[model samples]
Structures are given as structure tokens and as C-alpha cells.
Target: MNRSADIMILDLSESSAYKTNLKHIDFCGSPVINKDHWLYWGSRVLSTSEASTSNVLMRVAEQTEFLDDETFETIAGCSKSENYSQRCSRTSLQSRDKLMYIQKEQLGLESEFPQHLLPDGKFNVDGFILACDVSKETVLHSNHVINIAKSIAKTKKPIVIAFTKCDEMSEECKRHYMTLFLATKELKHVLCNLPPVETSAVKNVNVEYLFGSLAMLCLRSQKLVKKPPLAYHEASLFVEQRNLHVKCCFSTLLSQAVPLCVYPKKFLSWKQVLADIDRHPDLMNFVEVFGSRVAFEMYERYVSEAKELWAMNRLRSHVPRLFEVFQVFLGVVDLADMEWNMARDYMRCHPLFSVLFENNDYDLGMWSPSTFNVDEKSRLPAEILLLPEAGNVFEQFRVGRSDGVVAIVNGK
Candidate 1:
């Protein structure tokens, strides 16, 4: 019984069709390569000598389960016809098996499995790579690839993303490939940052890296020695980093929370606020800020305000949180005053004011020279009024003014 023969490689490349056929020649009792371009097998060693045509060695000892010959024949025929130039020669067996064996062994799957199944009769292979043809663009095909990859990854194995047609992809196709590559990298990062084993894939980019990682994981699982838990400090560090990431996301949302001024009186209703926030390009960021119950409460309150309440509420909510975290304005007495002034300034400069006050009876003549010029002494009023030291001067001015005023006493 050869435990090392547990792993196998299923190559779906045009070059591997003949070699894949040689699985029928002997009872290797290991895994067999399948038409799906997946290596449905397990391995025992972290690394094995490269398989060779002259020295064909069995890597695993378990009986391989394969579909019937008819299926195999159909697949083989398709490979030959579809990929004529790269088709594997069907002439020889010894050579073919050796090639197949070598190709399968190269993936390195020793780290995936435990010494054996976990008392439960489950089949585990250190991880398997489910390679697929990039030429196929159908949603069904991609789904099939994903399903197969998922099934293999579920066996506590890391999957290697592999693809064909690397040499034939167009520039645009290559760009798409790079996009997928970055997406895959992001997926891996997300998985690693998470509790582990949350995501896996079998695609073209990083396939080899995935294979090597899977091998290491399988080997670790086999050792059955529980790794020591992280120290408190280390755990704390991880938590801090995670928090930093969340804060960064919130900052992004805050940056994008500029006033849209679409509603009348610049007053965005709660529904409008929700709709606008929901349209944010980075929805995750919005969710981080406005997704919580507290944030939603603030959002509702701000939306009900008369003018651009959403922006005002967002600023207010964020300012407190920011101060709490960074302690920026702890001793600052006029923080709220400064914040309200800033909001007022922003509203005053906003272009929406032209539209918001278009229907109102109150005139903005004070701000315009055409209506009331500063150089005209006739417009000046007597008893120069001062706002009694407490309330806002602007509010008093708005309330106290009539159409025009005249000087009271004789002046020099």
C-alpha cells in the first residue's frame, strides 16, 4: 500500500489527452485525472520527484474512481478534434503514463490531508486543482468550473487556479484576465484575513501559487498537532488593523457625502438620502457609515431638516466620532459653533440657493450690490443697532430690516 500515491493530476490540456487515457492501463489504486481537467486525488508527501516517461512511479495507493470508458472516449475525441495541433499522441502507453504521472505530481498536494479521514468516512485529498479551458465563455461552463473547484476546496484542500489559452488571449482579453487576476488576489487576501478557508478557486493566474499553498496546508493537516493560539497582543494587533480598515472605508464614504442640492430648499428627505447613499460607488463604505442603527437614525433626522440636512447630519455624526477616536478637539470650546458656521457658509455658497429661494418672498438684496450698495449713505439707518451680545447678528439683521432706513440725528 503506497500512501504517497494518493495524489493525482487531471490535465485537460490538448497535450494531456493521450496521457489521461493511460489511467485505464493499470490499477494504480491512486487518483485518476478526469475529463474536467481536475486532479481528483490525494498526496502524502510535501514534494515528490518529477514523474518521467522512463521511470513511471505510482504516487498514491488508493483506488481511483473514474467515469465509464464511453465518457472518457468522448472527451478524448473532443480534445483531439478541438485542439488538433496540441493534441497528445495516442500511439504509446508507457510514455503516456509517465507523462501523465509527472504532470500530476508537479502540483504538490502533501499538505492537504490528515494522516487519514477523520474517523468519519470522508474522502480527503490534500487539495486538488480543477483546471478549465479559457476558450469556453458560457456562464454554464464557468459555473461548472466554479462548482468543481468548490467541491475540491471543501475537502479542506487549497485549490490552484489554472487556465488554458494563455498564448492566444487578445490584449482586451488579457486586460480582462488581469482584472480577474486582481479579483483573485483580492479574494485570497480576504480569505486569509478572515477566519480561513472562506474562499478558494481554480483559474489561470496564481494557479501554481495556490497549488503550493494547498500542499503546505494538507501537510499541516496531516500532522494533527494543533498550532498554538495567538498571543493576546497579536490578537489585539489583528483587531486594530481590522478597525483601521473599517475606518478607512468610513473616511471614503465621508469624502463622497457631499451635498447634491437636488431637492427643494436643499432639503433631502430620508428616502432621498437613503437612495443617494445607496447609489454610492463604494457601497461597502456607505454601509460602514450609514448601515448601522445609529447612523440610520442620524440619516433620518438629517433628511427631515429644511436644507441639505443629510450633509449636515453626516458632518455632525462624523465629527463626534472623529473627535472621540482622535481626540482632535477635546479642549476646543467653540467646536460646535465652528461646525455650524462651516455648514452655514457651505449653504450660503451653494449654487442650489438660487433655486431654493427662487419662490420665497424674502430678498437676498443685502448680499447684492444692485439692490443695496455699501457706498450709498442714504440706505444707512440711525441708531446703529448692535446684536445684544448673545444671539446671531445675521438672524437679527434678517428680522429687523424694512424696505429702507433713514438717518435720525444731525451729523457733522
Candidate 2:
């Protein structure tokens, strides 16, 4: 463990599993809001706190105080979307002594590159964010993802791989991943051009240096900015990397991108986007994958619509209200605001998120027993793995030019 700046940093970056320096007595913690659930925490930090050099998880300054509410996360005069308070978590608690830390639940948020990269509003590269829970015993990825990757590979298109969840990763794995990334001809150039630094995701800073080769690969990857389409210059790539907390690091890598056309434009809101997505068939495959956009819309709609969920005589919007009812039920406040809020909902945010979107893989109900299959790894789908000769020079000649650059990353 070392100190970077004024904060004492704990290095949990060892490749080996947790070998205890020592263990302390377990304790229970309560909230200031007079909440139901109590934090049963086991002291993990002994000599020094287990922190990474780039760790944003624990802030010694912030930990000095006890905040029970998002009350401190307020803004003077800004919309919920623009508020820095969104950066502060509500359910999480930070101890003044900094011995225990509350594991964060998902906020139903996603960060994706824009769908229209260039000013022409045409998209070329395919983007995907595959997620795995490191807290789980095994990391699970879908067979469908492998199938899509294989198909993309068969066409001889450009493909990039970035592994996230760096904070949870061991130092050895970080080095290995960095080495692999740098070994790639394109990614090597990207790292060299940009300084290696880390910061909070909400800062929303931008530096234009993907594999700038993304432009050489696609005539469109030319001069670009991370701002929205309106900030786009004529014939330049314009993609607004919107609201994703961790996207500050990952989004810049995709050079050939398509802007969402929904964000950063005052005229278009999430409600309008959601309405358009539902109403028009032509915009169905508007982009290859709409997970991030759909996620953003879902979160916005969920929070905003829940305000009106209790209409006098109407069926409630299941997905959004269910999220609210499942969560706010235990609390005294938000009762008059909620539509018949009376559930014993002390469940974790993840499980509740699963049921709220039943079609998704996570099903705590036991009805959809198989959200992920471990056997999917045996089916290697990349064509190069199957068809490439040991050392055939002619094979290079046979390969087609890269038509697109596709990235598939684990969203852990």
C-alpha cells in the first residue's frame, strides 16, 4: 500500500487470491435516514486500506464525513440529468474511519459511443458492451456474442478488444491486458498519442485519439469531437459520449462511430426518443445494437414516469414502477408518491433489476434457471481460429480489406 497525493492508497492488485494480513471483529452499521437494512460489515482493511492508485471507490476526504442522503449531492439550478448529485450514490454508505465499504448496486446505466460518428450521420463500426459480474464465482458471456463476433471476423473487418473492470483486476492481469492491447498495431498508436491517466466518469472530459487510424480505415474517422452532433463540424466525425460513468476511458477508442442524434440536442429528449423508437419501424435497427440508448431511455423514463404512475384508474407501467415499488417500499417517504407501495422489498438492487426486466438473463424467480451457460466457451466462433493455416503467406492475400471496426468489451 502506498500514498498517492494526500490519500493513502491500498494496493489490492496482487495476482494471488486474498491472503489475510489479519481479520478484525465484524460489526453492524445503520443509516441516518432511519432505514430498514443494516450493514453487517467485516473489516477488510487492517494496516492500511486496500486501495488502487486509480481507485475512485474510496475517497479519504469524502469518507471523513457521514452522509445519509443524496442531500449533499445537490446542485444549485440544474436538471436531474446535469446534476452532479447523480454521481453520488444514495444506498451506499461511507464510514468516517474507512474500515468498511458498501458494495455498489447497478444504477441501470450504460455508456456507449455515438451511433452517428461522422457529420453525414452514417455509422460504420459495430459496438458492443458485454458484461460479467466479477463478484460471481465464474464470468459468463453469451454464445450469441461469439456468433456475432465470428460473423464480423469472417468479413475481414477490424476488431478491437478492451477489458474493463480494472479496479477489481489484479495488477498482473492489468499488465497482461495492457501488453496485449499495446501489441496490437492500432491500439499501440492510441496509447502512445494519449497520456495514461484516470479520473471519475462523471467529469465527461474528451481527448480525440482513438486508433486515429480509425479514420484511415474509414474515410470518415477524420477530425472529430466528443461533443454532440450540433457541435459537429462539416464532414467530421461527431459522437457525444453521453452520461456513462465509466465511458470516459473506453468511448474514445472507437474512431468510426455513429452519433445517437438524441442527446446534447436541446430539442430531443429521452421521452421523444423512446416514443420514436416505439412508433417507427425504420429506426428499429437504427444502429446495430441499441442497448446503451435503450438503457439511458429506460432509466430516464423509469425515474420520470414513476412520478405519475399512480393515475386514478390505469394499469401501471410495469418496468418503471416495479423498480420504484421494489426499492422505495421499505422507506417511510415516497409513499404518497408511490402507487400502492407496500412491498417488504429489502432485496438487493441487482435481483430487483432482473425481475423488472424479466426477459434479461438475471432471474431470481428461479423460473428462468439458465441466465448464462458456462459451456459456451467450448464453442470458439472466430473464423481465424478454425480456418487459418499454420504459416500460409497466401492466406494474407486471400483476406478482405477491413470494412468496419467492431469492439466487444466486458462491462464488469
Q: How many backbone overlaps does candidate 2 show? A: 8
Candidate 1 runs further than 4 Å off: 1-124, 135-140, 169-211, 221-412
User: What digit string (tens of lDDT, one per residue) describes model 2 on residues 93-131?
Assistant: 322322222332211110121111111211123221111
Top candidate by lDDT: 1
Q: Taking the candidates one at a time, how many backbone clashes does each contain? A: 16, 8
Locate the minimum summed-lDDT window of 10 residues in model 1: 381-390
Give candidate 2's TM-score.
Answer: 0.19
Per-residue lDDT over 50-147 for candidate 1, one digit per residue giving the tens place of the 0 to 100 score: 23212111232122223334455423321324332122111111111211223443323423422222112223344343333444333332332233
Model number with the top TM-score: 1
Error of 1 at 382 (Å): 99
Residue 89 lDDT in model 2? 20
Computed on alpha carbons, the lDDT of every model, listed in order, comes to 0.33, 0.26
RMSD of 2: 32.6
